[model samples]
Target: MGKMLTVTTMFLIQMIITFETSGLYAMAPILSNNFGINHSSIILVNIGFALAGICAPFFGVASEKYGKKKFIIIGVSTFLIGSIITSYANGATLFLVGRSIIGLGYYNLSGLLLAYLGDIVAYSNRGKIYGIIRAASGIGILLSPLTSTYLISNFSLKVYYLIIAFITAIILLLSFFIPKVEKRSSYKISTVDIILIFRNRDGRLFLFLNFSMGTFLVLYFSYIAVHLEAFFNLSALNIGKVLTYSAFGTLSGIFIAGILSDRIGKLKLTKIYYLILIASIFLINIVNIHFIWIITFIMSLSFDGGWTIIQTISSEIIPEERGVFMSLVFFVVSLSLILFYIIGPVVYSYGGFLYTTVLSGFFIIISYILFLKFAKNNTEKFN
Candidate 1:
């Protein structure tokens, strides 16, 4: 019963985050025209939201020193407030403020969710269960863009955010059921520890891979719908449908990767995911409307599959310092946001979506090359 509740709550968190994020992207073109600004202005909102990720390492140490459930409650409470503030936003400044608050709360909840689950589930069964949760997140990927389009076109952004706010309230209630673990005597991310973490080769490899995957997905969410509208003359509804179809690809990957990670071993499965990522970006860019969905699905699959393995690997590394290690790993991933935000718009301005995908493919290729160059069999294993 408890495990079921925990999984259900984690899935809800995935849904709302997807809901807001997909909506922001889908709304970008529409909002740009309404505000008389370019796409950059609307996409810049992600920077405000991503700023909260900067504090993750501190939150990680704090979660260990304090308790996981306590912070989750605070996170949920903060998210609820942010949702209210966002719903009432009439201008970009106000919207940015609301999203910033949402980010603050959101990173807290999202950062801790998997760790909370790890505490309860046995190691042997963990990967499979994690896969199921990730696949469920695909439903959010499937619906949010479509939902955002229909709501914004027929009603208002105000109504849409309010609905998100209501759902957040329920999540706050669900937050209480997350079982608490006993706290350790002391937890600290010391200066030596920080330095050593960066010096660790596998840490660097996975971190680079994580960053590449994260930045690429950010670009996808920020641009794909707009690209369809701009290049293909796709209506909002058709763009949503396209995104929805691509999500099935992600669902297939997450479900398959989860089962395979456990069966084939994470390292073996990871290699396949990397190749798919590099290949998908190139293919996705070259394809026409008729073939875009196939490539997009393949691309989407690699992103989520790679992430699932990354999450599991982080949990396995430094079990005693799992919270700190996981947080630090994600902290590096967060840095990608600032870099991508600045560069994504410039890339799009130069040659449109095609340039963006090509640049992203280069990044993935670089990450893969670095891994092959530096990685050792023992690197991923705790040294």
Candidate 2:
């Protein structure tokens, strides 16, 4: 396939996956209603996505050993099947079982899309394209909450999932346009080599940053809908509107992060991004703002946008094994979510949501300091 066609194909497919992941938040109430459960318990559906994340490393390795094109096709197909099952599920356990299948597909699907980008783009332009592709994720982010809210409020949850499932079908058709990429048989690395990836010093930092950022982002999205409904007394429609506005901020953050990463050094820019993320979270937690909607919008932009920069840096950090590295990053992120999100509501139940938010930020601060101490730039050339 031609470069432009390939890029366009990848962008659209990634957006579908992104929508499925982020759109779940807007559908939380609907999922609860369908399953006859409460919102907090229904939040575990987000945990299913994270569980998929933990499996990314295995997918990363498989993509490298097999071919990216093949994995993308399989992953997308599996996601469609999973979504269909989940949509028809009559109970919470069956709903999660369906979600788990979709989740497993997500890891490979997301990892390969990124690794494919890493293969096509040169080092200098990688960050920019990564940002642009990431911005497409926001398109799905913008659509999911609003679309789900409208469908659920006006129609039904079953209809909403069916619509998204159809969209996923379109995404799968577009997957054909992506160029095929085969793993380097001679360059194949063992599980031991994967372990040695952590010994790279900077690799460890990259992994930790990936983990920390994942914790904060997932926690925010997982519960933001519930918070809006309970604390601010916003309806599903208004929540979608609020999320759409915040997505604009996130969109801007993504583009600017890419531009800045190219101009500034990746490391310096990432450090600054983390600081911005920390400050934004602090404001949300510490301030007693009555206009909670405005705060949520601003902070979502800062936090999500800043993390895009971190992701760009990560895509750069372990360039040789982009698929594997990204997989590990996704895995760590999923691990954190399963541990945090599964128990987070309990923490919120007793300690308050503010406590969990503050704790996530503190973890970011700690991880940032460690990354600053150990992470280093690559001297190896990529053209």
Candidate 3:
């Protein structure tokens, strides 16, 4: 019962964070019109989480020594405050500030959530719970579009954001119920200690895989909506509906990856996902909207499923220093987001969506090669 509560709490909390994260994208068209900003500027707003990730390694080290639950409290509190600020923002500047703070708070919880799971759940059975918890995470994005449409259409953009605040507030209150966990590591550490994550052989492979595959995080997302609007003339409601349908892919991906990862082998299944993601990216073409939707669905499923497996293996790579390692992994993930946001728009602007997909496909190809050659076995012998 106790473990169930923790999993449920973490599951719900992850869903909320992804809600806030994906909501900005779902609500982008409205935000652009209301604020008089372009797609690029709207997307740039998400850089906030990447910015906050800079501090994550330090927090990771602290959590290992001090406690995860308290930092979790602090993180959720920040998210709540940011959500309220977003709900009440009067203009583009204030709105950006509010949303930026939400990103800053996002990684504090996101990076730690996995590590927190590592603390209570042993490796042998971790996949079962990871599937449930992580699959639940996809639900946030699945509904963000529909919910954003409802709130903005019926109430106002302010209400749309405030609903997020209200939900977050409830989550903040429930956060207190998280059972206390004793410190996981006794060693003193600093931000520099994260370098250890790179020292091991598996750690090096993880970093490579993270970078190659990490770009997938924002690769298509940076301009998918803009492309849809420009090319297909889809309205916000239609786009939201489309993305909602696509998010089901994430649900399926998480479930299958979670259940099968333990039995089949994490790295092996990850390879298949990587291939699916690559093929899906290659199959992306602007000629047909239905084709695009199918590709997007495939991408969503493979990305979430494969990445979950990668993160699952990551927790075991440096068990004693998982906090530091996860922070480092997230830090790389932040870099990946930064890379796409910075490079994606430029490629899309000059080259169009085709060029952007090609670039992303090339990145994954490199990642796949590195994983196959270097990580010959599931677990690299790390000393």
TM-score of each: 0.93, 0.92, 0.94
Write down the lDDT that model 2 would get.
0.75
lDDT of 3 at 379: 50
- Misplaced by over 4 Å in model 2 are 186-188, 286-290, 374-383
Q: Give the whole-model CA lDDT for all candidates, comma-separated.
A: 0.76, 0.75, 0.77
Local accuracy of candidate 3 as per-residue lDDT tens digits, 149-267? 76886788778778888888887877788887888556587435656557788787776677666676676766666667777899888888877866888887898898888777777
Q: Which prediction has the highest lDDT against the true structure?
A: 3
Which scores better on TM-score, 2 or 3? 3
Give the candidates in order of lDDT, highest first: 3, 1, 2
Candidate 2 per-residue lDDT over residues 63-119, each given as its tens digit:
888888888888988889888887786677767888888888787777678788888
lDDT of 2 at 145: 82
Report RMSD for candidate 1.
Answer: 2.2
Clashing residue pairs found in predicted model 1: none
Tell me the spans in candidate 1 whose CA falls farther than 4 Å from its real position. Answer: 372-383
State model 3's lDDT: 0.77
